[model samples]
Target: MKILVTGCAGFIGFHLSKHLLEENNNVIGVDNINNYYDPNLKEKRLNILKKNKKFKFYKFDICNEDKIIKVFKKRIDCVIHLAAQAGVRYSLENPDAYFQSNLKGFYNILINSKRFKIKHLIFASTSSVYGNQKVMPIDEKSDITNPIQFYAATKTSNELMASSFSQLYQMKISALRFFTVYGPWGRPDMALFKFTNNILRKKQIDIYNFGKHKRDFTYIDDCVNAIKLIIHAKKKRKKFEVFNIANGKSEKLEKYIKIIERELKLKAKKKYLPLQKGDIQTTSANINKIKKFVKYKPSVNIETGIKKFIEWYKFYYYKNGK
Candidate 1:
């Protein structure tokens, strides 16, 4: 399959692109490589992908309609749209970035996918859209009307837009609502990376929501595998659907930190802090809907996931002398 993957340098994008390439698929990857966290990390991921002969890359933002249209000119079998301004707290500081990238950029991808007559358009949404629902283990039918964070609001908007496009133009689209994903080459802004880095450096790691928050922390490999399965799953007769690509288990923030400490074999200086704005108390996914659709089941546990991440973190940082 010839697949076009946006944000190929991103944490999930990098892993997804690599998986597809390894499966002998022709992949065209695009990313602006913005410095949301560090462009160096993005470059490192891109470099690895570039090593594969079947992989092609473009360093353009998805908001660039002309460039995106040019890429769509190729016979693309599917498009995995993972590019977006992602972060809850960062949304509080810079809402426009979210509007431009998550909203406007997504608009470009949707229209172009239709124009190209792509068979499947798989896009990344977030569990954050659940918006602190009173219910446990959020399903696709959960309330999406109230997104506490602008980041979640934009993602929710993408879901609506994708559904409308699918119904209007008979486009096949799947939105995967990813839970808290972590693993090697993960984003620096994510909690696991931050905690690991601080712990290794013997610095104080901030525990948010007073260390009471619970999260469905999905491993990178598990999340990528779910995506791969969905790409090849029996297509639903419907033009649109959403699935929760998560671990199907929630772990406490306090316990999460302890696991990291144990893996690092070092205690972290913890600083407890109240929940910041746009933070949810808990996020757990009802992945039965996904399982039914694609036979998806998360295989990596948190303990193993953290150990792999720690090994990568130490090797990468120590090699770089950071």
Candidate 2:
């Protein structure tokens, strides 16, 4: 199978593309390599994928309809759309970025996938879509009309838009609601990466919500594995579907930090702070549907996942004396 993965230079996209290539499938990856965080990190990820013979990469923004159409001229079996302006706090600052990438860019992808008669369109959604739902273990059927953050609003819009596309064209679309994803090659903006760096630097780490937030931190590999299983599922494809891909275990923010500190043998100077706007108090995923449909199992625990990430971080960053 030939898979086209947008945002292939990104954290999840990079891991997913590498996994697909390992499965002996041809992977065509595309990313604009925007400096949302660090283009250097994105470049490093792309360079690793370039080494694989089964992988082909394109440098283009997904929002460019012409370039996206040009890339689809070749047969693409399935498309895993992961490109978007990510970050809740960032969205509050620049709402236009979310509109452009999440809304406009997604529209371009959907139309092209429909134009090419693609079989499965697997796209990334977020647990943030749940948006203070007043419940634990959020399900696919949860009320997502009121997204607290503009970023979540864009993703919720993506789900609605994708559903319309699926219905209109009878397309097989899967919107994966990813929980707090963390692991190796993670974005510097993410908590795990920032906390690890701060702890290593002996800087004060800001503990949001007075260290009371609980998140279902899904490991990158586990998240990618769930995606692989869903894409390769032999069942008759549904016209539209949504699933929660998560570890199914909610861990406290403080505990998460403690594990990282233990792994690094460095205690972090903690500064408890109030939760910022556009942030949810808790997030837990109800992944029963995903498991039932695709036998998806999240095997990586938070401790093990953090250890792996720390090892990679040290090797990738510390070796250079940065």
Candidate 3:
């Protein structure tokens, strides 16, 4: 299969691209390599992917219609669009970035995919779209009307926009509402990486929401595997089928911290702060639809995933002398 994976330098994108390449798939990966946190980390991931012969990469933002269209001129089989402006808090500081990348970028991908007549278009969405829903296990049918942050609002908008395109263009599209994804080569902005880095450096770790928040911390491998399954799953051109790509488990912020602290063998100096705006109290995904369709079952638990992350983190920082 010839697959086009956007955000190929990103945490999940890097892992997914490698996985597909290992299976002998021809993968053309792209990323603007924006310095949302550190472009160095992004470059490291891209370098790893570039080592594979089956993998090719282009450094361009998805918002560039001409470049994207040129890439589509090839006989592309499917698209795994993961590029977007991530981070709920960052969205508040810079809403326009989200609009340009998440919204406009998504628009370009959809238009090009439709023009190219790609078979399947799987894009990334976020659980933040659920807003402050009191529900424990969020399903695909749950209401996503109340988005507390601009980031969540934009992600929800993406789902709606994708649905409209899918219906109008008769394209097969699936939006995966990813939970708190974490593991090796994970985003520096994510909680796990931040916590681990701070703890390892003996720096203070911010315990947001007074250490009361709970998140469905889905492992990176599990999330990527679910995506791989979706890639091959029969795509019936339904009007925007959305699934919560998660482990269906929730872990409290404090517990997750303890695990990281233990793994790093360091005590974390913490500052407990009130819940920030756009932050949800809890997120647990109901992955029934994905499971029913693709037999997707997350194999990694929080403890095991954290262990793997810590191992990688140690190696990474040690090699870098940080």
Candidate 4:
């Protein structure tokens, strides 16, 4: 299969692209390598992917319609769109970036995907779209009318747009609502990385929502595998489908921090703070829908996941006291 993967340099994109390449699939990669966190990390992930002979890369933003069209011209069979401005708090500071990348950027990908008749278009959505649900184990049928964050709002918009496009063009589109995914080469902006970095440096790690927030933290490998299965799902799926790709378990914020501390063998100086704007107290996903569709089950537990991340983090950033 010839697959076009946007944001190939990103945390999830890098892992997914590597997985696809290992499966002997021809992967055409695209990423703007924006400095949302650090372009250096993105570069590192991209460099690894470039080592694969079956992988081809294009350095450009998905918002560039003309250039994106050129990539689709490569006789691409499918697309895995993971490129987007991703962050809840960052959305509060710079909403324009989110609009440009998540809104306009995804719009370009969606339209061009239809024009080229790409099969099995799988894109990354987020569990944030469910907002602060009163129900436990938030499912695909939850009411997502009220997204507290602009990032979630944009992702929710993406799902609606996908639903419309799939129905209109009879396009086979699947949106995976990812939970709090963490692993080696994970985004530095995310919780696990930030906590690990700060703890090792003996810096105070801020615990949000007064250390009471719960999140369904999914491992990178499991998340990527669920995507791989969906890409080649043997069953006929609905034109537009949504799945919650998660660990099927929720861990509290403080509990998550303790895991990091245990793995690092060091205590972290913590400061409890009220939930910031666009922050939710809890995010739990009902992954049964995805399990039914693709037999998707997240295998990595948080204990081992954090240990793996700590090893990678120490090797990458916690060395030489730099």
Q: After superposition, how far is residue 53 of candidate 4 from its true place, in Å?
A: 0.8
List the candidates' TM-scores in order: 0.98, 0.99, 0.98, 0.98
> What does candidate 2 score on TM?
0.99
- What candidate 4 gets wrong by more than 4 Å, as runs, is 320-322
Positional deviation of residue 213's Cα in model 4 after best superposition, in angstroms: 0.5
Provide the global lDDT of candidate 4 against the true structure: 0.92
lDDT (Cα, tens digit) per residue for candidate 4, span 50-137? 9999999999988899999899999999899999999889999999999999999999999998999998889999999989999999
Best by lDDT: 2
lDDT of 3 by residue, 32-53 (tens): 9998988988998888889999
Candidate 3: segments with Cα more than 4 A from true spot: 235-239
Question: On a 0 to 1 TM-score scale, where does candidate 1 land against the true structure?
Answer: 0.98
Go through the candidates in order and give the clash count of each.
0, 0, 0, 0
- Estimate, for each residue in 1-322, the C-alpha lDDT of model 2 and write its tens digit: 9999999999999999999998899999999999889898999999999999999999998889999998899899999999999998999999999999999999999999999999999999999888997877789999998899999999999999999999999999999999989999999999998999888888999988999999999999999999999999999867999999999999999899989989999989999999898889999888899999999989999989999999999999767756
**Global lDDT of each candidate:** 0.92, 0.93, 0.90, 0.92
